[model samples]
Every structure is written in C-alpha cells, then in structure tokens.
Target: MSEKLGAERLMPNEWRDDLEALDLEIVRFAIICQVKLLEPGVIQRVLDNDARDCIHGNQTAFASLRGLLFLHFQMQKDLAEAYGPSDATEIVRRVWAHLQPRVGDQLGSLPNPGALSAV
Candidate 1:
C-alpha cells in the first residue's frame, strides 16, 4: 500500500488576518469556512441544547457533549487568539449587521454582545 492518497497538497489558505481582504474577487472566491461562517449566537443555542440533552441522559449525548465542548472551547480560544475577548460583542454586532443589511450601517454596527435587538 502507498503512504499517500491520490492527491497533491494544495496551497495553504489562511486568510492573512484581514477580514476586509475577502472583498476582492479572487480572495472572495477562495472562501474558507472558519469562525467567520458561524454565528456565536447559534453556536450558543446548540451548546445549550446539547447541555439539556446531557442533563436528560440522552444515549448519544456524551459524544455530542464532547464535540460541543471542543467547539465551545475552540471558540473561546479563537477569540483570545485572534481578537481579545473584549471584542466578542463587536463580532456579534458585525454578524447582526450582515443579517440585516437594510439597517443603516451606523446603527446596525452597534455592539450589543449579549443583547440582540428585536428584528
């Protein structure tokens, strides 16, 4: 058996730390789903649901719990690693802005970390 599969290693595409650069055509096409694609709020809900399942002793909850924990911790690590925890709320607001493009930028861009305004 061969050590390698039928493939060649492609270019490494860690988006050089600038979210804005994704606006370019080539850069935009080179989409990679990272923490950017996930909405922290939704991840929170999934975590919450998984916790509840754990409480109820769902048969598969243990595996689900482990994955969720990794995801949870990873998100925390990502925040501390990329932008300090202080900026977590701002990140959420930026998500909200994308969610409601009709809203004016100034207002839509306000940071409401824990509190999502009524749509």
Candidate 2:
C-alpha cells in the first residue's frame, strides 16, 4: 500500500482503510450476487484468461498476480463500462464469494471470507 501517487508516498494506514472499505463493499455485493445465483460472464472471461496464461507457461504465482490485476482493475473497468459502477461493485462482490469457496475447497481449505483482505 506504500505505492507512490506522484511524489508522495501512499500512507499505509490510509491505504489499508481504503482496502478495508473496498472489501466491505465487495462483500455486500457478493451477498447480493449470490442471491441471484449466476456467475457474471465478465468474471468467467477473466478466469478463462488466467487459465490460458497458465497453459501458456505462466507460473502459478504469476498467474495469481495476473488474476488479481484483471479482477481488481480490468474486470471492474469492463463491468462498470457495461453495467455502471454500483452494479459493477455488486458483481465484483458476487464473483469474489463465488470463486473463493470453490477454489479453496478444491485446495482443501475453505478460507474464511475476509480473512486475508486486510493483509
């Protein structure tokens, strides 16, 4: 979170606060998305692209980095453009919850939602 904005260092506390707020918003949207019970197509495309990268020799670690970038930046951008920011936020939340449990269970550990968001 110490990334620079222009010349000033991004304050750690403020960055964390922003991240936490984002996490809460995402959680709320996720709950709403779950009620709808269908994965947004945009999310699917992001996952698909990640899978393609893995198949083309991207290491798991790098693939994860790419996935994060796509989800937080690209996916949000695309969803917001197509559906507006508020709706896009909901989709992000839904996609987060939808993906997390499935991936975690497959790896034999169901992550507590929000457990690692602060880190």
Candidate 3:
C-alpha cells in the first residue's frame, strides 16, 4: 500500500523559498570571510540570527538549514584536525562554492555576516 500522507507533508512552496534564503545567508557568510577577517564571536552571532529567524515560523526549513550548517562546520572542523590550519580555509572555500549553486537567487539582499561585526 502507498504510504499515508500527513498534514506536515503539505508544506507550501514558500518553505522551499525559505530554504533557498537560508542557503544564501550561508553563502554571504562565506564570502565575507573570504574578503576580510572576522572574529569568531561575530560569525557565531550571524549564524545564530539566521537559525533563529529560520526557526521562528518555519520549523522544517529551519531544521534542514540547521542540520546542513552543523554538518558544514563539523566537516570543516574534521578537515582542520586532519590537515592543519593552512588547509582549512581552502576546504571551506570549496565547500561554499558547492553550496552557492544550490541556493541560487533566493538569498535576496541580506547583509554580509562580516558587516555585522562593525555594528
């Protein structure tokens, strides 16, 4: 028999849009880090804000973005542990490039995370 569909399965197309927005946020963060140095605390705040907004009204998309972000950080940490600091930045750059296409134009005009540091 076919699996029964639940109410939760009926997500609106907006949620996909939200996920794409979240992806753009991640890409912005990566770009800022590339151009200028950002403090760790600053980076954390940006990620926290993105996660919070994503979580507030859209749980499913938020959860997915959170998971992806977590995995991204974990993989970066693992690579750092294995290859040393010199290689960590390059790995992160490549990862960000891979993610950019997936997010496409959904990012809108969100501020770069690094810019937040000055505020």
Instruction: State which candidate has the highest lDDT.
Output: 3
Q: Worst ten-residue run, lDDT, model 2?
A: 31-40
The lDDT, on a scale of 0 to 1, for candidate 1 is 0.34
Best by TM-score: 3
| Candidate closer to the true structure by lDDT (higher is better), 1 or 2 | 2
Please report how far candidate 3 places residue 3 from its true position, in Å.
44
Q: Write the per-residue lDDT of candidate 1 for residues 22-50, one digit (tens) a residue.
A: 22221111111111112334334434544
Tens digit of lDDT per residue, candidate 2, span 16-61?
A: 3444445444434433232111232323433454333122343544
Compute each candidate's TM-score over C-alphas. Answer: 0.29, 0.32, 0.42
Compose the digit string of candidate 3's lDDT tens values, residues 1-119. 66535322323333234334544565554443331113334335434644333313444544444455555465445444655544554544444455546644434332443232122
Considering summed lDDT, which 10 consecutive residues are worst modelled in model 3? 31-40
Sort all candidates by TM-score, best to worst: 3, 2, 1
lDDT of each: 0.34, 0.40, 0.43
Clashes of each: 0, 2, 0
- Give candidate 3 misplaced runs (Cα > 4 Å): 1-52, 98-105, 108-119
